[model samples]
Target chain A: MDVVLQQLRHTYAAPGLEARTVLMIDEWQATSGAQILLRGISGSGKTTLLNILAGLLPPTTGLVRCGGQSLYALPEDERDRLRATTIGYIFQMHHLAPTLSALENVEMPLVFGRKLNAGARRARAYELLDSVGLRDFHRHRPLQLSTGQRLRVAVARALAAQPALVLADEPTAALDAESSHAVMDLLQESCRRTGATLIVASHDPALATRFDRVVDLRNGALHEAETL
Target chain B: MYELKLAWRNLANRPVQTWVTLTVVALAVALAVTVIHLNEGLQRGIIRASDPFGVLVVGAQGSSQQLVLSTLLLQGLPVGNIDGHIFEELRDDPRVALAVPMAMGDNIGGARIVGTDEHFFDLRSSQQAAPAFQLAEGRIFAADFEAVLGSRAAVGLGLRIGDQFRPAHGVEPGLEGDEHAEVHTVVGILQPSGTPFDNAVLTTVNSVIAMHAEALAAPDASTTTDHAAGNDHAAADLVSAAETVSAAETVSAAETVSAAETVSAAETVSAAETVSAAETVSAAEAAHADDHAGDDSHAHASAGQVTAVLVAPVGFIEANQLWRDFYTGAEAQAVFPGRELGGLFDLLNQGQEILILVGYLAAVMAALTLFLAIYSATESRQHLLAILRGVGARRRTVMLVVLVETVLVAMLGALVGRLLGYGAAAAIAGEISRRSAIPVAIGWLPQVEPALWLLPLALGVLAGLLPAWQAYRVNVVEKLFPS
Candidate 1:
């Protein structure tokens, strides 16, 4: 789905402590099925902006509109439904549920989305696991898999529901150079095949050539960057 | 559906903690359910034991509970035997439908030698069609020294048809010098009644009375001939006639076994009657008529000495009339076995109720344990819960997962508790049967199951709420990528 952000702001609050503004944006938008890369250093609110776009965290000011619906303007349940069907999130770390197997981890979104029954869910999960080339290790738990393999399982999970927008935050942050390139290739290839709007947030400037547009976040403000 | 599957996988992964919580809940429920089933089955078994005793039991003037316990349930020594004529009086009473006398006090190898008439075997009371007791083999005892053993008594004492055993003076076995010299042959074996009576040894009432009279005369006699002559000359005549020509041996040793073997010449002449046992309308009447011929030395034998009388009046009004009349008398008291026994058991039921409350408290503790289990586990899974929320699972879905996990634990515990309850109840019933020598069976009391099952599940639901609330409020962005 196409995404729009208009004058959004959010602050972090803690008890008996300090409140800090973490994210502020005048406007940002990603066209439908476009591949975009967002680059930022640590504490630059890369995760907070993704959270707003995913309908997870409502910003303190302004609205994030996805598929012509202002996410925060709708009820919390409706926002949750939109997140299940339209937006897919990949965290900084490969956060597969430790108890679930690789295939089950891929099936998580489809299970909660309730768009398919058990048989269809398993078929889709098997297809995703096969595409990631971890079909043989699909029954393996998170603790049994190598870091690269777990990240691959997480990628398959993000696209399990065939969501319109795929947001990947530091999908290869903890990987070595070769493993990072391989994981990025697999993630980009899967998104391209599914025609999903891909937004990858990372501080890796070397990844600028992999996207159609590249932007950098510094001091909670967006900056256009020249593609490498 | 997705939420429950997730919850189940989560719990299944933590097998040790899940099993520990389930066992705690099961133990609490098992303890409580055993007490409940025990109390219910014991009371029901006790009541069922008394069903054959007719409407009212009249015995000596002492404890009415003891009278019922001893005469109806055959549990202990009677308060004291009422006058034998009282049984005779009740038998001929116009208001009485049936009056069978019970003479207890003697035992054969730990089995009570119940001195009663043929009517004791099969009571034709209005309660049911089938007789309470039936002869499994041989025939009912008629002449003195002929006895019928109960099913358990035959096996426990290792006696069969035509086998002989002497009666001990008291109700318990293993009393030295208390056994009668009279060797009563087992003429029959009764079918198991599943009551205390399954271990009884039944003989004629007159035989019991005559045996005791003969025992009473033995200490006073100067010689063996005098011992037999002083009680009843017919006894001496019969003992000598037996020794001289293998005549019927008269063994008047124990007080309750007085006339068990005191067969006179007339008894020898009626040996054909003893075999067929058809000559006697009831065994007691035949023994009285044939053995003692107008002998004044053994006045007790002629009059009879009975343990108790089972009285069933013609109607409800007649029952109350007979009960009141018996109550007015100073000699004995009449008790409706159920009402008298119910009052005693109600006190025990109150104790069971307290145990049920303790069971509920245990269930609450089990629920709290579940809460702690989920709460502490959720603390570590905040990251995981955030991921689930990030993957499009609603806050309510997360809450529901916790609820489903806890409730499933409770339901499984209840299922296991019910089986444990039955096992514990059977164990208790077995112990009671072993100690009392009575076959006590387990019974299901109505309206008692839901307490065993539903309460734990409800408590599980209640306990899951706080931990579920914790999961529901998890911050997706904060937990997923913690700073």
Candidate 2:
């Protein structure tokens, strides 16, 4: 399913600062089986546009259609249900449940959907962890593991549900150069294997080259190019 | 299910808050249990103290009420006395089945000396089924001037079968000879009855009569030199009443003659004429005597008299209606034992009502406290609740999980509290039984309440309801409003 943004605009206002339009994307289209990179410097609206595409934030003006569903037209509950079933989120911080082990955290969505008992859920979580090369540390909490290992666990958790759309915000930002490359490789490999569309928001042009398409965000506008 | 997990995790996350709330609930449960046990125990004690024998009949002149208050309840002394003639008429009446007559006003060696019949012994002693006035060591006295000792009296006076001791004339201290009617033998000892009767020295009515008769015979007996007084260096033999003659006997003889004309100057020293000492003799003796005459006059004098009777009905229904007719007739006062007991219970139950109120209030407060604890915890878990909702846990399921957790806590607290209460009851039951002279076998049975299981279970469910409702009504969409 292709994602469409027609005259999409987002604005931000603070207590004392001048109100600014953070994002303005018109006639933006990401066709089925296409990858898009949102590239921008800090405060250049890369995250805002990606968030709009992820259906986590609504545009101030105009329509946003993700996977052929008009998110804004549905009630809040319906929109949340659609987002949970279809979209996979990978935040910069991973936002894993602290109380659960890595395996339980990965299987959390299946448990919520009542699709698995505790034993089945744990088994599926283990398989996903093994796929992400975290079989040895599947039972470890996020705090017990290193930053790179935690990111790997986050990737396993995001892809466990096998969603149609995966959205990652700075997925490799916390890793060093080598770890960053490995994390990017794992994310790309998982998305390719599952045939899911991946949208990543980042400032790195090196990561942009690996995707099918790269779009740059400059002066609150999108251009058909990636900048180093 | 997720909300329950979150609740448990949050409880584990804050150990102090959880412990404080649990401690409050536990203590409240314990207090409730204690109050229930105390109220129940006191009620049982009252019921035990007032069973089997329901009504008491005493001398009408002396206030039948006072006799019950004093003899049965051990609260006061009688205000007047009834004579042997009246007592005999009542005892021989068709309605009278069993009568336990008691006499007061004497103390022997610091123990009460009771003048009563063998029936009094039977009335005071209760065994497994029948009474246990059957002698413990020896036979009960078959004649006057012979006595039976209570268990405590025998032990306290160091008296045994065949041992002799003088009765103290009144409830006052003295080994005076005037008080010593011929020294009475202890023929039997009564078995323990767990009552005030155990502390009394009992003698037949004739023995009490003989004591006063001998006091009349020898007014100078106390003046005689006690031969056993300087007997530390001598044998432990007591001087016989026949051998204790002294100069005081002359004065005593003169008074006896003046007191009785047959023993007066008209008769030959009355040596061969053994005194009959019956009613006719006593009335004639009073005519010749001054103080004896006053006693005779008092004994027979009755300006106001009521024909009193004690009726034991042939059947239960007849017994119940006996008092009703008396009430309707308005001329007589008839008391049914059970009705009197019910009245007594009514009077006593007023205090128990206060206890019940306080106990009910405590239970309500406990429920409210538990409600508050669960509600506050759920309120603070709004964010976690939202996360659980987003995870796909049903609202009803979340509420049910919370309810189950609360129910578990309540059940556990109730169990612990009940155990503690019973343990406390068992520990003190012995001392209480001893002091109050009540018989209770100490065992594992909790005497608090038979329905105690229901109390905690119901409370747990009740306390869980509010939080369960809150969990059910939680809105999931509020968490993702900005989306």
TM-score, first chain, each model: 0.95, 0.90
| Candidate 2, TM-score of its B chain | 0.57
**What is candidate 1's lDDT per residue for B358-395, written digit by digit as tens?**
88788778888888887887777788888888888899
Candidate 2's displacement at residue B181, Å, is 18
Candidate 2: stretches off by over 4 Å = A12-21, A31-35, A43-61, A79-84, A130-153, A204-206, A217-224, B54-93, B96-483
Q: In terms of DockQ, which candidate is strongest?
A: 1
TM-score of chain A of 2: 0.90
Candidate 2 lDDT tens digits, A1-228: 578888888888769989899888777887765666877898887766765665556779989887787868877545555545566667666666666678877886676555567888788889989977889987787789888887888787777767677788788888788888887887788777777788888887679768878887888888888333
Each prediction's whole-model lDDT (CA): 0.74, 0.58
The residue ranges of model 1 lying beyond 4 angstroms of the native Cα positions read: A15-18, B125-128, B168-170, B173-180, B206-302, B437-439, B444-446
Name the candidate that leads on TM-score.
1
lDDT of 2 at B8: 64
TM-score of chain B of each: 0.81, 0.57
Q: Candidate 2: fnat, from 0 to 1?
A: 0.17
